[model samples]
Target: MENEQKTYRIDGFSCANCAKTFEKNVKNIKSVENAEVNFGASKITITGDATVQQIEKAGAFEKLKVVDKNQPKPEKQSFFKKHREVLISGLFMLLGFALIIINDGQNAITTGTFLISIIIGGYQMFWTGINNLSKLRFDMKTLMTIAVIGAALIGEWPEAAVVVVLFAVSESLERYSMEKARASIQSLMEIAPNTAVIKTPAGNKELPVEDVRIGDIMIIKPGDKLSMDGVIQSGSTNINQAAITGEALPAPKSAGDDVFAGTLNQSGYLEVEVTKNNEDTTLAKIIQLVEEAQQERAPAQHFVDQFAKYYTPAIMVAALLVAIIPPLLFGASWATWVYQGLAVLVVGCPCALVISTPIAIVSAIGNAANRGVLIKGGVYLETIGQSRTIAFDKTGTLTEGHPHVTDFMTYGDYDREAVLALSAALESKSEHPLAASILDFTESEDVEYSTIHIDDFKAETGKGITGTIDCKIYSIGKPENFDDADAYQSEGKTVMIIKENNTVIGLFAVIDPLRESSKAAIEKLHKMGSRTAMLTGDNEKTAGAIAGTLGIDTVYAGLMPEDKLDAIKNMQSDHKVTMVGDGINDAPALATADIGIAMGKGTDTALETADVALMGNDISQLPFTVNLSKRTLRIIKANITFSLVIKLIALLLVIPGWLTLWIAILSDIGATLIVALNGMRLLRVKE
Candidate 1:
């Protein structure tokens, strides 16, 4: 049988290190050819004939769970059920302390209560620890279990009970913090409606989204959330697309306009024909991409993971040495050294450090996705943080892309209308982009022109066109092909010359205008210390005019696709370059740059090829994305540093005999909470 890959969501998968260990064990199973565990998303994927039973067996050592990805999540437990052991352990600890205070540490009840707390709180840890210890797999749980058991063996019952109770609380808080970090992504799942009203031949019928097929007409009322991607067939409305594209204002949608799933129809009643099914909707793609992006670890995260693999065992050795060497060689007090060893074990868990980078990455990516930007991975997000040079593609990126007739000049009393009509009549037969723009302009102006048959029509690729109308030969070519080309070229406009029997009749100057946001976005990039450049295939005059208008720092004009790619590479030699394009002709440059950002309106090839995508084709979001990335990286660094500093302080305390079991556990828990909350701050980043 061919090996098929299956993904399963693993319940109770809180520890990143434990997930790594589980993946290794699962991969060892005879039926499994490969296994990958995504600690951030709590998912495991396996290839070959690996059954859930085999997966469960692999993770059974740590009490990890394996469930099919298609299965709905189990119902949440009540508060008591969720933290039964912790609450029970806490009560026992309190009773023990109370008895100790009441009886002055002399009663059997005090000792019994402490012993009960240790048994209740530490049993789960003890079982898993012993299992892993037997297999020589030492982890945080194993360290805590040893600390508690060793303290008890030395007659420190109260201390052991306190360690057990505190450890339980720490585990609970860690799980809660991770859940908080993941909540951003979980919220995205609720955006799309589960049921949609479909228009049938007889009437409209409400059906599950899965049952809705392509080409089905959907009837949407005011305030109805769109259930699938479709085009408006009739009626007009304003749609709140903030959920998908993050456009702040509701977009006005009319006939033939496309509406995405998960956006609300805010104003009017409408009928839309579904263009895609539920699974293929834009909202579905965003969710999947966001989840997958979170799963790919960052460079810093990989380093921490590799460091942690050895960190635990090394700590174990150090703790053992601290317990035995001082007592044996230095003749130090056995109890003192042993207590210090237990403290070291408590400080060695690595929970905060393991999670420091991933939490920030997940939060930043989720926040970016929610704000109409899709960053593909942590590495690219990090790359954006360090970028210093931004190179923009001129047409369709920095400019409106649709050229218009800016100036029309007529010679010898020939009216502008006459020249325009003749040019439109000749250009109507062409399928060029410029031709479409001309047709649109003429149609919008309601220009009247006679359609006359022209024979012997010929188009030159770089110069212009030639045709014979009514036995009269007319040539329309570049301004340089006529006499007044430089005057139009000086104004940064593309000039076309029209002649009657080889005598110049008139000229038209067409130009693609700058986008409204181009100037502001470039200014923001410059303020952020990014040098801006415009790369275009247009003439130097046109490119320079745009660069001057937009205040771009540099310009590379008259370049082909290959030249653009080469320019990107040359720029990368000194500075980290970011290339922004519509993602079609700029494919090679986008690939060659350190990072590529594609506009949402670009072709699918562009969106697929670029590292980041700006939805709604808004360049204004680019500066915000850069700031967000920098902020995210800063937070991640702060988290890692904070974790290390806390651990370092705790370790130093072992020298002064000031590190207590409760203090050690609290420090680790405190660092974990701080980092998680700090990472979650990314969700609130704004312009």
Candidate 2:
């Protein structure tokens, strides 16, 4: 039988390099067919058979622990406990310094104390580095190990000890930053309750979410967070959906309304019928997608990885020449040149450069997820940031998606209420799409039409409906039957005529209204230097009206699916265009655009197809996502540039032979910390 693939949480990784090492080691296992480590998520996936003990042993160099991915996370250790080895090493180093001062020079006791400190603090680094060295792998660990061992062989005991302790501290700092970045996903995972109060056949019993099947009724009370994706079967409430949509306001929900797991029921009691299993819940899918997103390498990350692959070996060769050439050509002291070469090796660790892009990518994606923007990958994030044009699908994207009565006018001898009441009563019996709008309008006007009854109702396709009310004949139908229909159609409204005994009495003009946030969102996009366009299947007039109202730069009206795709392709000829749509109907255009953004309330197809999802279903999040993506791109460039510049400056110190082990290691540590902290700033980005 074939072994199934599984993913497990991993602990004890100190840096991205360690994660790489662990992943490589796991892949080397005899029974494991494949292995991948998600450094940002601190999780490992293995294909084929591998026992927990076997996987743990693969990471033994780092004392890595493997746990079930679904298990509750272990409580955090205190700083001292977490860094015990480094702390112990530091204590011994301090003792060595004390001894050196007492003796007024380097001696046996101080040397032994420093040696103990180095062994304690750098054993893992040395072990992994030496193992990698044997295999001709020159990762950061191998470079640091070679540098530290060289420093010791040259009798620089105190500096070597300090280097070891400082390196460990730097790795610790890297781990902490990764943890902080991962915390966004962790917080999301913790949002929904683990169990739910299930209404069972025997009695109401609280059960684990996984044990609750579809059709199970979940009882949620005020202040309770829903534990399943379900529909409200009974009662009503206001739900705070910040966990799912990042919307601050509490949404009102009544019977038959949908509710998602992780959302809080702010008021009222609800018996919700479960619609999805625990692992299939929207929250679960978000967590899964976010984790998968972290695993994808951005274009910048690919460049950095390739650069580092060549860069590390080049540094080694340069260091070799620096050590031998000066001594052979100019009769410089071998010890001095060799020491400088080792310093060069230490300076070229690539700690910061290796992490510059991924940390930033992780931070940005995690932050976006927290804000209810599900950016699918770093590539999408970068594309969105670089996009110059944003194209929107008109109906559900920019408009209310359904028609509403926008204008009502009455003619001679008929009062507005009397005409509305008769029309509403007649239309209520018709099953046309426009009928709902008429009934909705009547309700909004507070007209007593529901109590009015219609008799002898007859519908005509593409024409109108006729009925008798209060012993009088009433007719409502397409505006083509009325002479004054041109005025409404010219304004992009659907006109319906109401007549008494075949004489026009009133007219109802309907149109799908724009979303309240659409205009402001478009203006914000324009201010941010993005040009906007609209693509719709609606006629030229309707599409032009909406485009004009929103100040859009271009409009592609009467577009079929292929036409929308062609429009996107055409737009790409001039600029990078992002297609924003309801996801299903716009899939072709979305797939063709530079980036695809879908409204969260859209179908599952939308969620899976789009490069990004605005969970609030409001375009207001569009400008925010663009701002975030642009900011993330800027920060990534800054991080890579800063890391390279710092390395260049440190390497230049070789001109005067001013570079020392202390200065080289400190530069690496400083650059690593700066890059990490800078990447973390994405977490603070707000709308």
Candidate 3:
């Protein structure tokens, strides 16, 4: 999450205006949690669940990539920067002391030094308070601004100078703490790789990835960052997509495999046909999502954001009460309360509450990323914990997308390879997962395949293939394609029986087996007071069997994309529906559900569509992260309430003259320290 107070580089930063403009630009990005542009360095680090697509659409950066390279870092002001204003005022105080030693307080040196110090430190307060007073904004700043000026007007210049300088120091410390809390979020820039070598027809040309565009042919050497989203057109390679999808195994790819923009090309050379425009590439989409996530406030966290808005103004009125009512009521000195009020005002800023929740969120997101999960934003974190319904894509999500031989009903004593080989020969040129799987299995056994009339063959979405073989009507498809009365499956996927001439052959079965941890995950979620359901495009038997085995509460099988979404909407009233899937076809359901949990190693579109990507294909972490979110929300609420209570108590004590400057400082700042320390506990959260 981008923390507004967090430091980031302002590209080509020339002055204060540039910093402000860059900050504003970054903030305008939908999911940008916060944008703090340091004018010193020409770089921008944006934090959020903003994907590259949104950013490219927003057009914020003419060209902005995260900057964490070992360039010579710029040197900011030393520890003495915040103390400079105080140092000048202190010099005046010392001058006044010299004058006092010579001829007493009435001397010109003493008078001049006192006047100078007061003017230097109290001017900002005077005008700011006047501004606030004009707005009918009876705030702490208004009271202190008037009080400090009054102190100087009455010849208490030294005291006035000390007050403002102290306030300045406290503000400085608050800023520093904020900087520390936002450190981890800055690491998000690493999501974009620095370089890319585009492949032109002439040869491989090395260029920065920023210059890449859509439809450009690119050659990837061994161990190269995939610079743009494209499909592999040539060469065989095993790519490590772990960073993008969190899978441990290297997926083998040949021609026609789509690779994402930010992933790694692990082994072998490859030529890719760019499928996505450069601006709308996968990497860009990730950045955009992160940014959006950061800007989106969690329901529980919003309380803190609003708390600071009122707390500051109320403290001002309380300060006035300390100055006015206390003197009138108890005949106590007005000066005492005035000083305490100033201290209260300084401590009352909502810096602590503002910093707490977002830090935890950013830390949690980072932690998830390290383990291969991509939680787009805090709002998703909030919803994930409450989601009760789980929708899944049959292939790649529950069952492996890679096809398998599920049945081999012998017809007239046909050999195993007899049907397998014939089907493989027909599907040898097909690109569908089941087709590829059949071909892979048959080819592995060195079964000879004779070319068939694949040109006439057509792939039916969610079903199977259809074509003529040897002048005989042949259809190889899901069991659902055949009459339900004619073919039936017990639990898992079953291939249908179709005749090449007349008599029926046998059925072949395949399944994308349940994720190794899915059953355990479902059980854990059930115990956590969440009802678990399954949504699939499989037949009644396969879906039902998987549901029963995993102890799922409900099952929706043989559903279309739209039907899945509509079913999710039906469950929306009483529960948050979490759709977990791993196919491009599941995109709509993923988008429609309360939480779109995408399997990381799924397709690029699925990865982008999902709200939370289970990075390693392990469904167990899904439940763990949800539980973590709930726990985090509780801690955040505690931090906010605790912070507010301390400040409120201190405010009461300040007006009644019961609390002094030291106690006020301790109360206001101590709560902040406590809140910040509590947020750091997120780093220790067990993943």
Candidate 4:
């Protein structure tokens, strides 16, 4: 009486009363100890460990996520659930075989049992088939059901039984596999943190994200993430926003940067200035849009819907002809004609073919999720597979996005390495804006610098850095700060020019480098029948230099926010185009593309704007995702073809008396089973 207990996070809740209803239903468990639910939390906390499977079988969405007191992680798929669906279908197969072998060459029991199995295994499907047909439309299920039953009525027990069993098993496998595949996208909605910490003048507070409002100050400390859309009015650090921008490196952030919630602050501390509440946060919107887009459906899914509508009615008519015409028109014995008609019905069921497409797509979508690639659903999965062109945002998508000193042009009294040594010496002591520039130059080019002793140093923010190095005055500053306006061209990026003994030395250009994986990913995509293009607001020169370095096919330079969308539409008209960018200004373009892939390293809003979001900003996964989509689509088509051909040929043979009823039923079930296993092969497709 004091042992069992159960708990769950029940969603779509109406009220506490609804929770009570679930609690009451679950309390019936024999071993259950006690069930305690707090409606405010939307979760039931159980006292003792208990089996919750029975409750799950009571409803479709009522999943049993946890089985024990502590709410165990999702349980493994039950063994009973896996093989149990085949019971009725398997019985039909066994009955047809038994009738052929055990019953005398002409016995009533054999025929009766064969029909009984058909009735039992396919009764629901038979009713559904008729219902769909009665609506003046036919689908794959209707066709299969009509053929098998038509065969059975003609006394072809073997064919009738096999046809129904085959349809049943195939449909079951398709449902199971597709649902399993969709688990990936579903997982996104599952693991998202729903709560946020609210900051108040009276210390710190933990509250639900919904309770959070705009303009609230929140303390975002070490190891804590922003819970609402906010700005950094105070504090600074490097944030690893790979989940948003798909840029793996942590972006250095300071005051005034609009930081989003759900992005991890890898290091440093910040007092967040809240801009938007939970509803408007990047994560919520991304989840919402992805879901909406997934449900919108694609143009291709209609193909199957159309095929199923006509195919069913047409096949039923064929089965009727096979059963009734031969004896009436050709003088064949009633038993032989009926048996052959039965064979036709069994083999002609198109259940496998009908379900193959969605199952494969759903599975691929799910598979991408497992790899941290959030493909919205079958719709986006199919689009990605069909893409012939890919547009990449250069800043964070194709580059390291970490601004580092790359090339240094030297000028005066100091040799290249001497100027580097002198600058490193004086700049090392100052906490200035250009410190990263100096450090990057030394590390990247193997430039060795001896210590330049500094006696006097000074820095002016938005101006430049100056210091005494080894009894000499050395300074590296922007042109505007040096009172030397004509010394060098602006060169676009903030240029750092060196001046020693009042003479201009060298100018060093600083830019973030391309990611190690970007070049390889571009090459691989080219090999996979996709051309790569770059879209950036960067000027023609910088964009051109990067394009040449990476060998990208096209570059759209000086593009404003709105222009990106038009660019995407142009590419999309001829070849399916996939847009990859850091989410933000790229939202419209991402939405316009055939498939929008957002780098996880940026804003949640940006990630939400696309069809697919990468969790790891590694460019390598882009190739992997595209290839995975193609592979999944290929498998879906193959499975559909395989299932359809077997069913059609089997039905065709039955009318001509080439196939026995027993052979028809076995072939139908066997083909459906094989198609299912083949579709599952997608789960194994890897980069």
**Whose TM-score is greatest here?**
1
Q: Candidate 1 lDDT, tens digit per residue, 41-81? A: 77888898777778888888556787653557778999999
Steric clash pairs (candidate 1): none
TM-score against truth, every candidate: 0.91, 0.89, 0.71, 0.62
Candidate 4: C-alpha lDDT = 0.65
Candidate 2 residue-wise lDDT at 548? 81
Q: How many clashing pairs per prediction, in order?
A: 0, 0, 33, 22
Question: Would you give me the overall lDDT of model 1?
Answer: 0.83
Please list the Cα RMSD from the true structure of every candidate, rounded to 1 decimal place: 3.3, 5.1, 8.0, 12.4
Clash pairs (backbone) in predicted model 2: none
Instruction: Estimate the TM-score for candidate 2.
Output: 0.89
Q: Which sections of candidate 2 miss by over 4 Å?
A: 1-3, 69-72, 407-486, 489-508
- The residue-by-residue lDDT of candidate 4 on 1-687, one tens digit each, is 565444464433222222344565456556555766533223465666554454443211222233332344555567656445457556756865766676556377766667677766776666655765676544455556566656656655565666666555555555555555455546544443566666777878887777777877777778776667788988889986644444556788999997876678778878787898676766556545444444444444557657755675666677667668878998888877766655555566555665566556555655665565777766777788788889998767887666666557776455887777766766676665356668767756576665445767887543567877667677776544443332222232435677886677866666766888888999999899889899876556667777887889998976766778888988877788889887655778888888888887434654556778886767788988999888877777777677777776776666456887556656666775676677667767778
Report lDDT (CA) for all predictions.
Answer: 0.83, 0.88, 0.64, 0.65
Which stretches in model 4 have alpha-carbon errors above 4 Å?
Answer: 1-119, 126-137, 140-152, 189-294, 324-329, 332-335, 377-380, 402-509, 536-541, 555-576, 586-595
Please provide, for model 2 over 416-512, each residue's C-alpha lDDT reduced to its tens digit, 9 standing for 90 to 100.
9989988888888888667899999998999988788888889975468999888888898765435676667667777788888878899998897
Give the winner by lDDT: 2
The digit string of per-residue lDDT tens for model 3 on 559-657 reads 766888888888887878888877366777788888888876535555567788875676767777777777777777788788777777876775445
lDDT of 2: 0.88
